[model samples]
Target: MEALSEVKLGPCRDSPYLRPLRIHYTQNGTRKHWDFMQTHDSVSILIFNTTRQSFVLVKQFRPAVYMCECARRGIMPTVDTASKDCSPQSLVAGELLPASAGVTYELCAGIVDKSDLSLQEIAKEEVLEECGYNVSVGNLQKITSYRPRWLQQEGTEAYRRGTNRHTPTVCAGEPSAADYWAAGGECRGHRRS
Candidate 1:
């Protein structure tokens, strides 16, 4: 993975990945302007290594997720502290983070923009880019599509956190594929749609 120079986004709200959006519409017979996120739609490839009964997952530090974790745990980042490099080794070489600020296990995913490629093609690219396993578009099948709308950060009043909905009610240690299936979070086998 190519490591880019560490760039601090001013005070957090000025993130380059996010842009403020204005939506004007009528609600309850009144015209109002609401702020919304114009973020790109995303796709995920939930790869299950059936032979090994394990899922191919990626563990990385998502600064956004890390921010919410910090707020939930009342931990703050020191101004001068920044991760020089986000690699596994360099990630831990900075000021100590809260216990909640740990890596997250997620499927290979990417935004559905930047190209006219279909979702299947995008999924294959993510699998290769994030998991290092080249996948063919023919073999890549689409499954459930999700919005992940629950993931909210400190934003405008319209998008502020309503509750601790992002927090998982139960924290389980790394589980097997079976465990994941039982929890309604995993697909036992790959089934093309």
Candidate 2:
């Protein structure tokens, strides 16, 4: 269910998701500046399927991952670095990166942008929307929270839940469990003990 096509790159001047920021500060009397993006906090749910003895994950194409893979493979185009003209045509006719290059397996996650919903509520909604599991907010066990230095914003509070319900169903435009399993990996940082 992951297909990325007609790829293009452009400068982002405004976005509802993130804001570019530069902070100037003095560390040990040395002036320093760091550029980062300010974004909403997020939550990730590790859906453990007790019946299957495996974890249920989400698989989707990440453009950032694709671009990084292309760059690493030395196949990315170098034209119009600051503009939106970077498209498939910018590279050799057959140089497009494979769709799988961008694919990633991750926990069901969503941003904490709704003001009226509590963190657990948002997590519950994400589980239903992304993973098609109707898990109650009370069943979500908080594991930990940590902010990634690169994002420079509030961290994601991780949760885990064990479910023996029927196989997960896919919401519209969401990846199916087959794709998730095909992507193949355990939930990072969490292992069966």
Candidate 3:
């Protein structure tokens, strides 16, 4: 996995992936507000390797998870902190958490930003790009769909089931695959218990 060093944090001025917004509404004759982020719907695939009796998973470092761990450990500012400046120097100066704190194992997934492709197609592409496995769209079984109560307002997440019949061929040549590897991310199989 990628090692974290010289970490820095700052305000997100603009992002194509997500937009933060607050909604004002009247509930039970009382006015209330809810803050959330508008993001593209996404798809996640659970890849099972029948040959190896394992699950294919991706391991990567998540900055958000790292920051949360830091805040929980009292080494960084919490989300409710009054100060908005989140520069590295503004955080607990000289204190740093191990990179392992941010490492996470996750299912192969991707955001649904393309308007032309179906959810199954997106899942197939994600499985190939992230997990280095070529899977047909027809083989992707839609398990269920749900919306997370977090910052994902109105964004639906679809989970699909995929089976890997052969060994993974890492597509390191693909731009997306290369980018993930360049950032110290990796794909591996976890034996099922």
Candidate 4:
């Protein structure tokens, strides 16, 4: 069985778009490694109050997503994002290069845990807590799930460990991207009350 034991911080670096972290750990049979360098796992959902056509959108700032805003604006040139070697002069100025550094618009989300609940259940709970609406689990639809590909590059510490570990990606692109499904039993009664 593959079991992870103890983790120690090795190296850390950041850019406007990504935060790279290196954690050393022992796993599996012999001495192994576990990397959590640039990984993201999240959940998003949609809730409908059919009575109102307008939908609820959660506004939040994601450090990884927003770090690119400065670069996108051209205020922080591309070289600033690609350069890994920092000169002694640059360090004297007390400047740090990052992947992205701005406020980003994102759906309501939270990380999934290995508890009794499933990922679907976690999604429903987050939607209700963030948007204040009850959602049907069976009606949940999967959107897009992925790990960003911009983390790997020369001179960057984005990739963690030996590059074998995989991160879990769970989101339907955006929170509003998912369609709402109402379960049966009291369609007319729910609207009336």
lDDT per residue as tens, model 3, 87-161: 434455468888789878877777878889877788877776666666667767777666443323333321111
**C-alpha RMSD of candidate 4:** 13.8
Structure candidate 3, residue pairs in collision: none
Show pairs that collide, candidate 1: none
> Across residues 133-188, which tens digit of lDDT does each residue of candidate 2 receive?
55667767666666443333234221112111111222222223443331123233
Output the better candidate (1/4) by lDDT: 1
Q: Ten consecutive residues with minimal summed lDDT in candidate 3?
A: 159-168
C-alpha lDDT score of every prediction, in listed order:
0.51, 0.59, 0.60, 0.44
Q: What is the lDDT of residue 76 in candidate 1?
A: 42
> If both were scored by lDDT, which would come out higher, candidate 2 or candidate 4?
2
For TM-score, the strongest prediction is: 3
TM-score of 3: 0.67
Model 1: per-residue Cα lDDT over 1-193, one tens digit each: 1132332333334444455567689999999876655455667777765546666777665767665665565544344325543322232224435433545777666776756787777776666566555556776766555434545545734346233222111111222334233312223222111
Residue 159, candidate 3: alpha-carbon lDDT: 14
lDDT computed for candidate 4: 0.44
- For all predicted structures, in order, the TM-scores are 0.57, 0.65, 0.67, 0.41
lDDT for each residue of candidate 4 in 1-193, tens digit (9 for 90 to 100): 1122221111235544234555666667567545453433556654434455444555543433533553454433233323466321211112333322433334556566546777677877666555544566665566656655644544445543334234444533223324333441123212111
Clashes of 2: 0
Model 4 per-residue lDDT at 84: 62
